[model samples]
Target: MDNTIFAQSIARIRSLETKMIDKAKIEAMVESRDFNDCLRFLQDTQYGSYITASNYEEGLKSATIDIYKEMYKICPLREVVDILALRYDSHNIKSLIKGKLAGIDTLYLTVDAGTIPVDRLNIMVKEENFRDMPKTLRYYVEKAFENYKNSQDPQDIDITIDKGIYEYMLEIAESSKMEYLLDIVKLMIDTINIKSFIRINIQERGRDFMQKVLLPKGNLDKDLFLNNITDSLESFANKIMHTDYFKWVKEGLGEYIKKGDLGSIEKYGDNYIIDYLKKAKLVSFGPDPIIAYILARENEIRAIRIILTGKRNDVSPDIIRERLRDVYV
Candidate 1:
């Protein structure tokens, strides 16, 4: 069966992922809160202590490198690697185009969404190799950049970029053979659409503006979202309640649509993805270190960023905690 190749590929990927996980635990010990334990772990793991003498942030770089180095030790599944590579490539493309359009310095944008190199990103953007990038990223860079170049409005650029990303992600997910991956992608699209709708319409913007910003993705019909929002939030919720996903947003939020309890929609979707993969890992064995683990780490990084930013701004931990997403252990 043709699936044999996929099965074999998965087996190799699993072996690699397990190796990385073990190595990562050792690295984590080096990064432990206890100073002496951390030092001992560092020595044991041979994670180099060469950090910038002038900046505390350099320690973060060193620690992150150790984490990823361990991850590399486990070996990644080809499909997992490809998916991540394409996602990061798309991000860099978006950053380049948006930075140019908004007149923001490229340095202000983050470089570490995945393993994308600055040199490769430079070449891709400089050459405008949208066609050569990846199927997952090609249409997004092209359409978003075209729209941004034509309009030059910051809001338009933001919306265009989001819409382009969602549309492209939806296309790929729909075509993908992996059921779990496709489900997660569709859920992500649903969340994006929901957020965009709320931000544009319920936030008092025009329906036309909402439509312009929304990506045409997911199982939900675009016209339904746009038309439903013309009524109250309850009506919209009720309309969605008929769908398979209605329970996710409706059960906890049905009573408080007026109070913005829906801000957690993104968090819920992210947690669901992580949880789904954690369960999948029990049944499957492959090189891909379960999408849940990756998403959880990503969420952890995001939470750390939010906390650090809040600290810098003197925002209370309470406020930061509210904004934090779920993390995997």
Candidate 2:
């Protein structure tokens, strides 16, 4: 436990959270009856608080990048930095390999997920040691190339790339010594598992084919979920009702009970997991400050983006508030 790094990371995350809270308060003030008060808040804080007016989905994506920028500033560990570098490098490779296969210009493929400089990733793509990229990313690039070569459909190739990334993420999660990181990875796996199971059972498509594509690091019994693939959605939900997650899943899925909108249910599952991780970060205080702070700031950025999106859409504040996930403090 290097208290120096731990304390610094914690302090940074708290500072970020406070800034986000102030932004939220300003946004709330804008929603109040006083248009003049909203104007005052806007003038006093500068327009940085105005992220609430951006497109919801895109804002979330930007927030992810912004939070990662902050995390990289505080995280001294080479493992985390290497992972980020590899991720961006892989994203660039995926774009290049896929774009070439599709007969499209390489510019069409963009890097959005990594902290690495775009020029650096481009250099890696041109280098012969692409296989030397992070182990997870090397696997992703090779798989994407292989999948593109074999598959005629672009969608199929893209799915192959995504599945490969998830598989690698799960492997990292299982092998890592950090319990919090493992939990975060497992939560991601669980969300993917839930979505995959529902799609398999309900649609009866791609049986035994994409089934193994799921990352299986979650606390949930992977075999149990797979075995129940033939059950109705309600039945599957009922089976897991004993767990603490059941209530959230039930409420999220209940909205589509009659309409049977699986997409919305899947979104609910993702949201819940994100919320769960935010809560998890709060309780994780120790030598793992690097892990905890990165995760917490990520969630806070997510919340800010959500609020910004809601305000932009002119959605009622209450509705937007209801949709807001927990921010780590």
Candidate 3:
């Protein structure tokens, strides 16, 4: 837990961070006349070597997996990077499970950068065998798949696996004894639980449903949500006014009231994480810097995807900009 051990990793991260795309570059992509022009803009940067307009999506995905693998190899406290990689693993697991049951191809949606190889995960799911999966993950997968077989409710697959991801992440963060990493994981849990709370309330699902989906060990109590299931969104926001997310949740509630979607809440949640990651900018040597750098890269890739997808689909620039999160730089 001595962050000083990350001194070398921090220096390497510092050098790599300089190449991160900035707000100006993002704007250039956003304003590009077409998708090819956007790819051309990226070609001038780090991704130019392989990112063709025709293959930009695959190129970007492949590059993402490569960068994560590189970062994982370089990080001194692998636990931190492992925490992030676990997220991708969790996401890939969900995509694989759903794809299998739905008889669809979700391969493109998988991010193959986790500690568990994505190909192995695909094989496990393909054959409906998970014995080789991580023990905690395998338990959840079997239970979810079994529940789905009986109930035929897809939400079980998502809810159960998501809970398993956070639970296992908490275990890693706690076992590493890293307070910064622990806080990040807890915050993610809180935000996800809050979002689930809103979704369940809107769906008219009760405490039983809330208990099924709401993750434990967050800053907010599971009962806090279970008890407030009947309250109006406004009242629920008021209920949590003393918590860290009061202001952000209230603002998102305002938008949800006007727009009938959780988009604003989700955007605010993502930006909040970016804000937390930015704290590492002042640290001289620690896992924080490395964690911030890789998450920043992930965030950067997301911004690029948003712009390119918007341009390809003819989404308005203004709307696209609205959807963009704050850059880590």
Give me the candidate number with maximum lDDT. Answer: 3
lDDT of each: 0.54, 0.57, 0.86
Q: How many angstroms is residue 3 displaced in model 2 relative to the true structure, after the best TM-score fit?
A: 7.0
List TM-score per model, in order: 0.70, 0.73, 0.93
Candidate 2, RMSD to the unseen true structure: 4.7
TM-score, cand. 1 vs. native: 0.70
Worst 10 residues of 2 by lDDT: 46-55
Q: Which ranges of candidate 3 are over 4 A from the true structure? A: 102-108
lDDT by residue (tens digit), candidate 3, 12-44: 888989988999999988998988778879977
Ranking by lDDT: 3, 2, 1
Give lDDT for model 2: 0.57
What tens-digit string does per-residue lDDT give for candidate 1 at 1-329? 13333454456545534533243443353234443333344343323353222332445444544444444444333344334333554465667766665556574353444445656666566666856555645665666667766876655555655555555555554455556556666766777677666555556776777677666657688887777666776667678877755665564354235456656665555555555556645545443244554554445445544544455456654666666655455
lDDT of 2 at 205: 61
**Which residue segments of model 1 deviate by more than 4 Å?**
1-76, 102-104, 114-116, 127-131, 135-139, 167-176, 242-244, 251-265, 286-289, 312-314
For model 2, the superposed segments whose C-alpha errors exceed 4 Å read 1-5, 22-66, 80-96, 105-116, 123-129, 170-176, 209-212, 258-260, 280-284, 287-329
